[model samples]
Every structure is written in C-alpha cells, then in structure tokens.
Target: MDSVLARALIEDPTEDGRLPLFLLFLAFLATFLITRTITRLIRAGKGPFRDRVAGGVHIHHAIPGIVLTIAGAFTSVAVDGSSPGAEIAAVLIGIGASLVLDEFALLLRLQDVYWEREGQLSVQVVSLTIAGLGLMAIGIDPLSDHTLSVGHLVIAINLPFHVAGVLMCVAKGKYSTASVGAFIPPVAWIGAIRLARPHSAWAKRHYSSEKRERAADRAHRFDDRYGRWGLNIEDLVAGKPTASPAVSGQEPSDPKGAA
Candidate 1:
C-alpha cells in the first residue's frame, strides 16, 4: 500500500480540481530545498558540489530554468487539463520556477549576490512564491470556486476589486499580505485597509508626518517581535551569509554547462 501522504495527494485530494496544483507545489518546494542545500554546501566549501563555469563564462541555473519554464508553460497551456501531459507540464514548471526563484536576487541585481546579505531577497521571494503556490494548491483561488450562483457571480465579477486589493497591499509594502491577498480576496482586502509601511510609496505619497510616525512605530514593533523568527527560518532554509562566501571569487555551479 502507498503511504498516508501519497493517499492524500494522489488518491484522495483534499479539494476538487487541485491535484495538479498540489503536485506542482510539492515539486517546486522539493526542488527549491534541494537546490538551496547544494548551493549552501558549495558556498561553505563543504560538499562535492561547486559553481558552474563555461569555457570562460559562469553559468547560472536560471538560464535552464527559463527554458524549462517556457517549455512547460506552453505544454501546460496546450495539453488537456486532466491529462497526464498537464501533470508533467506542471511538475516541469514547478521545478523550473524553483530554480529561477532560488537565485531571484542575483537576477534583480544582475550579479552573483547569492551569498551576500542581499541574497536574503532570494529566500524572501522564494518563500512568497511558495506561500502563494501552497495557498492555491489548498484551494484558495482568487474568486469563486466554479460554483455558479448570484453570489459567486458577483464575486467573480468583482475580480478587479480583488486585484486592486493585491496592488494596494504591494503599494503599502505589505508583501506577505500581498502574497496571500493575491490568492485570497479577504486577506488582500484587509491588507489594503491596514496602515501602510512608513517608507512605502503609499505612505510617502499620502500619509501626514504624524501618521507616518505612527506607521513607522507599528512597523518597528512588528519587526522586533517577529523579524528574528523570519530571519531564523530564512537562514535555516537558505543558509546565512558568510563574511566571504564562494560567490565572492568563485563561479556558478554545474561545470558540465548543465546549470
């Protein structure tokens, strides 16, 4: 017999029409964890893995990630949703997306900031992406769940309002909320109604000095209460920055040019 997890994921999915997404979430999460482990080991000079270098250029994993993402996305779009081809495409997309997000900071900076303090952005981005995927896999879609009714129709019709909530949260510098709000309408609505971060565009452009001070106070309090836990989690998942990590002078991984 298969294990309990297998039974839940493959045999008896918790939600209707979400098995493909569940598979994708699992694939993405597993791929990201494994890739981060290898990269961290390479950075610490503790494992067999090393950076990838071409004839003379360094090769980043994002290149192949981009290829796989495009190929899988097109295949997923082309294939029947319930078919095995769609499942394969979903897994490919998940793997490719994880690989790309694992070095998100590097892409934004256009350099190997993978082992620097700025590398934390990669972890943050990957975490948000995973959270969004996990929510979707668990059936937290943006609108109605395919059930047809007046209320469902209204909710679906108000999709633009929900989207605005997501954008509002982003503008207010509530990224964690924005990540959830993108999938769950109520969460975004709440974030949109909350106080904007003091340094955010919304706060800068709209808030009075007194209101900004209050926002800053609240932001700091929240950070002081929760930032340590977040940092610890990030470090645990992606490894902490070293004084002089391998990316300082070394190259990317996958020497056979598979990176």
Candidate 2:
C-alpha cells in the first residue's frame, strides 16, 4: 500500500494527473465503508461490544489521515533525493493550507450528531458535508499527478458550501451555543498539526476535552428538558388535584379559605 501510494505521489501515469487515483481514493473508500458500517450497527442497536468498537473506529479515522500525510512527506523526500527549493516551499504551503481545511472538517463532523438530535437539518448537512469533503480529499493523493490536482482542489473549493450551511444553522437559532464553542479545539488541531505542527499532546488534549464537554452538555440538556416528565410526585401527594385545569375550575371551592 505504501509503495503504491509513494509511486502515485511521485509520478503521474499520464502527463496530467487525472483521478480516481488508485492509492489516494482507496483510503476514502475505506473511511466511508467503515463509517457506514458503524452507523448501521449503531442504528440497529447492536451489542455493547460492537458499539464500543465502533466508537474506537470512529476516532481512528483521523489517524489514517495523519499517516497518509506523513507518508506523502517521506515520499516526496525519497523521490526527490534532495529538496528542491520549490518543492520544499510547496510542501510547507500545502500543509498550512490543508490544516485550516482539516480543522473545519472535524469541527463540523463532531457537531453533526448534536444537530441531528436537535432536529436541526441544516446544521447536520453542513457538518456532514464538510467532514465528507475533508475525508474525501484525504483519500485523494494531492502530492502526485498535477492533472488530478484539480480534483483534490475540489474539496477546498466546495468548502464555502459548508460555511454557508453553518451560517444557516446559526440563523435558525436552534443550536446550543456552548456546544459550538466547545467544537473549536479539534478544528484548531487540524490547523495546529499542519502548521506549528505538533501532533500528539495537543491533538489528544483537544479532542478529549471537546468530547467530554459535548457529552456533558448533551446530558445536561436532555435532563433539563425531560426530567420532570417522568416524575412520580403526584402519587406521593395526599390530596393534589388529578384533573385538568377546566375540571378544577368547575369544582366547588372550600367554605373556608383552606382546602
């Protein structure tokens, strides 16, 4: 796999790098297949072990992306044998640009479930699309084949659609603002790992914090909205009214001011 990817990156079969590039596309194909499988299991209410494993699989998707990038870097160095000034500059610039896109991709993806649960379709679409494009682009090997480069650029180009989708979500006034704020870290890490580029400590910390905060906020909101509905206080009350407001209004009042 590595050898094929390395070859694809360093050389183009045709003069122009047209895609369905074999090496780059397979990664995305894998991501989508795994994502689909896990989502199906989750929806079908599969066993607890499957659920746990799915969660782990979900997290590891990002790691493959990082690995692909590292592979590209090494491939470039190996192919060129020495750094040409232009190639070196291009690598740096590409990393910087890609990091920004990566951050937005993960940020939106994390909020997708929240959006779905809240019945915010617009936000869900935006989040899913951004993540999808990012995941797709990661599958495309941009380091090779200049002709196929435009296909790689397609991911970045379509980013505005995601931005518009996010704006629509904010306009709807349905999103939890706190959750949006908590979403910043993973997105920021996308940028951080690409530029200034420290991967392990910061990425882990940010991802963990975002996950914890979102989970806590979701539970808090769920309880706030539904906790009272399941209460059994009525059974414990000695003489509380058990009828509608209209029925209580028609009932005779106590002679005294007391019930």
Candidate 3:
C-alpha cells in the first residue's frame, strides 16, 4: 500500500505539476493537524511544550511560516518541474502555509486573537484552503471542468448565472458555502436560493421584518443542528476558546493571549 501510494504521488502524466500540489496538500493537512495538537497541549499546560518567546516577544508561528513559504515558492519556481527539488519545495511550502494559515486571523487584525471568537476565522480559512487544494490535487479542472469548445457555449452563457449565485452566497454570509460554491455550481445555487443568515448583509439590508424573523429562526435551527457540531469539532481539534478575549492587562497570565 505504501509503495502504491508513493507511486501515485509521483505520477504526473500530463506533467502539469499536479504531483507537487498533491504532496503540498498532504503535507499541509498533516502539518496543520500536528500544529493544532501541539498548540492545544501547550494551551492546556499538559506538556513540556511552550509557546515560543524571545526577548519578551511572543514569536508567533506565522513568522517562520512566511519565511518557509517564500523560500519554497522561489525554489519551486526555479527548479525543473519534474525534479525532486520541486517535490521538496512543495513540502516546505505546505508546512509554511499551514503555520501561517493557522494564525490567519492574527494577520488579518494585526493582533493576537488566537483564542477569541475571531480565531474561528483562521480555522474557516484553513478548512477552505485545504478543501480547495484537495480538489485541485485530484486534477479537477476549475470552472466548467472542461476545455472550452463551440459545443460548450452553454457553459459560457451560464457562467454569469453561476457567478451571481456565488455573489449571493457571499452576500448571505454563508462564506464557507460560498468558497466551495465558487468551484461547485450546485452548492452556489443552493446557498443562493436559501434564506440569508439573520445578521448577514443581505438580510440586514433586504429582508423585511417578517423575513428577518424567519431568517433568524432558520439560522437558530441550523446552528443547533449543524453549526454547533462543527464548532465542537473545531474546539476538540484546536483549543477551546475563552468566554471573552483576553485584554492585554486583564489576563496577562493566561497563555491564550500569548499566541
């Protein structure tokens, strides 16, 4: 099984660089999971591991991740496409990206929000990245999933409709759904047709009072049924968040703020 998998990983029939991408996907997934596990253990104070600190500065993983990603990307670009160097570069890029993305919310806000409600954005981003990479690694062509031809004019004609659906999904604040639906048309349609989240921009601007109430009801049911489950899994994998975000002086001793 190991040998077969190895063979498959190296296979690049079209030589379009899918092999490196696949390795990157696998490495990214592994690195993120391992990093999350280590961080959780560090958070719980259950292990010898500690967050990296240097000269009174908390060294976030994003720094190293940025360096590695830049180094790997340059090397990947420079090396022969089929060379072992490309594969090695892919692994480096993958590891680096996982670290960076694991703390994406920090980069977004220019602060340590790792253990806050805002931290959830990092997980969401990472999840979408992984899913998108996985799909591409499997050689799924994007958009219409086929080369353009005169026979496929319908696809070109329908492209705007799909884009509209994706836009509506984003407006509805079903961001995760929108990310997936950017590639998969059916998902976009479903999200488009569905009621926007009660607090979404679409709902706030367009929904009438009665529609807003209905949207809220639907949102509550969805959260109860599925959203909470996703959050529970996220908490299990990443560390559980604190009741409130740590203010600089409020919880200085709390390690959650250190990240």
Candidate 4:
C-alpha cells in the first residue's frame, strides 16, 4: 500500500510542488480525528486517558503542540525543500496544528473552555485551515499566478484594484469572501460592494445610522436563514459546543464576532 501510494504521488503531474501539502492535509485529518475521538471518549468517562497533570496543574495538549510546531517549523526551514525530510516536517506541522487548533478557545480566552460555545472557534479554524490546504492542493495560487503572468505595467495598474477589493471585503467583515476574492477578483468586488455587517468596523466607521440599521437587518436575515445549518455542521465535525457558565445567560454570540 505504501509503495502504491508513493508511486501514485510521484506519477501525478499536479503533485509536483504539492507532496508536502498532500501529506499535511492527510496528517491534519488523521490527527484531528484521533484527537477528537480521544477527547470525546474522555469526556464521556469511557477512556483510561486522563488530563496530563503536572505539579497539580492540568497541562493542555497545546503545550506539546507548540513544541512540535516549533520543531517542525525549524526543520522545514533547515532542510532542503526537495528532500524527503520535508514530508516528515509537513506531517509534524500538520499534527501540531491539529493539536493547537483543537483547543483554540483556551488559547484565545486564556482559560480552559474546551466544551464551551467558544470552542466552536476551534472547529472554524480547523475547517478554514483544511479548506486552504485543499485549495493549494488543487492548484489555486491566489494572486501569484496572475501576477506572474502580467507585465510590469499591467501589474502596476491592477495592483491597487486588487488591494482595494481585499481591503473592502475585510472592512465589510467578509473574511472567507475576502480570502477567495484575493484569488478571484470578482468575488472581492462583490464582497466590497455588499452591505457591511452591522457591527463590523466598516459599518461603524462609515455607515449612516439608517444604513447601519439596514445592514443589521440584512445580517439578521442571513443569520436566521443559514446560521443553524452552519452550527449543526460545525457540531457534527468538531463535537457539540459546550456553554460557558459566565456566558450562559447572555445570548449566543456570533461565531465570528464583529469580524
């Protein structure tokens, strides 16, 4: 099986500069699945595994994740790009990313809230990372390919438009749209021209009171239409979200708060 897989990777034309990316994706998926399974089992009190306690302090997995990340980063930087070592480095990085992102909420809030609503952030981050890796593996180069093809004069003329689109999308709180728009100019333009999210920085800074109300309405409608579905999917992939005691009384906040 290993020989066959290796031969397939080597024979594939699109995998030329993508072997590490493929390995990274595989490692991330494997690590995330394994981690989630173990965590769930622990949560259910069905596993022998317990939290690692050192000196009466419970150690989070992210500690080891950080170390692995640093080691993988350094290894990737030090080794030849074309060497087989790069694959090992990619796998290490992927595993590290999975471990760290699995507890992303703890890192963000500086507290243990793995089962809380905030934990959804981990699912979001992991999903985004996976999507990004998938795009790269499929040969999407964002701005690089277009920039390389254009002449200096054309690039000079087009650069500002691209920048403006990206900036506008970001300001309007359209992150995923902005990311895609960076690769496909039209997507950026649409995001830019669309109404800013009501609580977004752009809306606060630039929108009139009336426009802000309209934006809020639109945002509400969008959330009502798709929010539950999105949340369900996140739960399915990353496990159900746990509610934090402090924030339990408050209304459920948007996942990408005021992005």
Best by TM-score: 3
Candidate 1 least-lDDT 10 residues: 250-259
| Candidate order (TM-score) | 3, 4, 1, 2
State residue 57's C-alpha deviation in candidate 2, in Å: 12
Candidate 3, residue 111: the lDDT equals 81
Candidate with the larger lDDT of 1 and 4: 1
* Tens-digit lDDT track of model 4 for 26-62: 8887888898898888887886987789999998889
Estimate TM-scores for all models: 0.62, 0.29, 0.68, 0.63
Please report, as a residue range, the 10-residue window in candidate 2 with the lowest summed lDDT: 250-259
Worst 10 residues of 3 by lDDT: 250-259
TM-score of 1: 0.62
C-alpha positional error of residue 24 in candidate 1 after TM-score superposition, expressed in Å: 1.1
Tens digits of per-residue lDDT for model 2 on 1-259?
3543455456543333232222233343344344445544555578443433454455433344455556556665665533353244334333432332233324444532211222222222333433543343334444443545555565355445544433332332212321231233233223222211011222233446665455345434544664233122211111122233212233321111000
Give lDDT tens digits, candidate 1, residues 1-259: 1232243345444346677788889999999889988887887789789889989888898988898889899999898685787888989899999999888879987978787644555665676577667645755454645534454455456667777777686667665555555556788788788888776668788999999899877777777776456445446665766555435554321111000
Better of 1 and 2 by TM-score: 1
**Model 2: per-residue Cα lDDT at residue 33:** 45
In candidate 4, list every pair of residues with a backbone clash: 115-242, 116-242
Q: How well does candidate 2 match the true structure in TM-score terms?
A: 0.29
Q: Residues 1-259, candidate 3: write the lDDT tens digits.
A: 3443354456673366577888899999999999988888888888889999999999999999999999999988888665788898999999999999999978987988898654655765676577667656765434544554443454456567767876686567665555556567788789899988776667788999999899777777777667755455556655677776444554221111100
